[model samples]
Target: MSAPIPNRVHYHKRDRELELGYPDGESYRLPIELLRVYSPSAEVQGHHPSEAVLQTGKRNVGLLNITQTGRYALKLHFDDGHDTGLYTWEYLHDMATHQQAWWENYLTRLERAGASRDSGVIQIHQV
Candidate 1:
């Protein structure tokens, strides 16, 4: 199947959501945090499955800029000093479609590693 082309892209600063509008009267709101965590860069995805890096403390990350990379993708400039991820239309659509499952998986990994999204603040619980 061919990837859907985005007609327009709008970033809502207050909502931290990237609104992607398509020609087929469809739209998707992709959260900034999700984009950051799932960045399609070697720095994040790594060279191999075993080398994939788990991103943390990115719950409040923001998008700084978006540059068109030909007709295929957009280079995402993030506020957290990350500007290497080129977000393709296909990738963005997939992420939006499976956001729930992907987010749940990310949270599960964080829990297993005892990592907090809140600036890596380790919470102490009295047992």
Candidate 2:
């Protein structure tokens, strides 16, 4: 068996897409919006999977900066002052590959929860 080959990745700012070219001659395009909401930061993902809070009001959000977190991951800063997620290469690749399924699931979850992505409500309380 041959070794797995690394893919060539590219970011297109104008189109807001991240493209990945695989050695097997396959390519995929992932949107910036998808990447931002699916960020791996604790602020976005929380401490556990059950603690993940749905992100809303980010339809027009865009990437502000992308800083390398060593050679294994990237720290993406969104324009909305959200600079917490650390996206590893593997996680990013998985998100890109499963974007459709993940998005559908998210929409279904939102509908079931009677939540709107554009809702601008922040629920906070003090003990």
Candidate 3:
């Protein structure tokens, strides 16, 4: 079966979801943080399975920009300075379908590595 093509794409800043509407009356709301963690770039996915990097501390990440790349994909520029992942239609569909499982796996990995979703360090200034 062929992957469904997206008819409309809407990024909700407040909700932090990239909503994709398909012709088959289905819509997927992909969270910005999940998209950032599951980025398909070499920096995240790596060249080999063994070299894949586990993305941590991105619970509060947001989308900075989204640019269409040709007719097949969109380049997502994240607020955390990551702008390399080209999210293809098929890739998005796959991610949307298996989001729950993948997210659970990510949480497990984080727990094992003692990583926090809050990647940013805030400096407190006392007057």
Q: Whose TM-score is greatest here?
A: 1
Model 2 lDDT at residue 120: 78
Off by over 4 Å in 1: 125-127
lDDT of prediction 3:
0.89
Write out the backbone clash pairs for model 3.
57-117
Write one digit per residue (lDDT tens) for candidate 1, span 1-127.
9689898999998898899999989999999999999899999999888888999999899988988899999888999999998999899999888999989999998888878787858867667
Q: Candidate 3: how large is its RMSD?
A: 4.9
lDDT of 2 by residue, 11-92 (tens): 7778877776768887788777777777787877889999887876666677777777877777777778888888777787
* Per-candidate local distance difference test: 0.90, 0.73, 0.89
Give the winner by lDDT: 1
RMSD values, in order shown: 1.3, 5.6, 4.9
The better candidate by TM-score, 1 or 3, is 1
TM-score of each: 0.94, 0.76, 0.90
| Model 2 misplaced regions, further than 4 Å | 1-9, 119-127
Error of 1 at 85 (Å): 0.9
- What is the RMSD of candidate 1? 1.3
**10 residues in a row with least lDDT, candidate 1:** 118-127
- Steric collisions counted per model: 0, 1, 1
Writing each residue's lDDT as its tens digit, candidate 3 over 1-127 gives 7578799988999998999999988999999999999899999999998988988889888888898999889899999999998999899999889989878988998777767777764434458
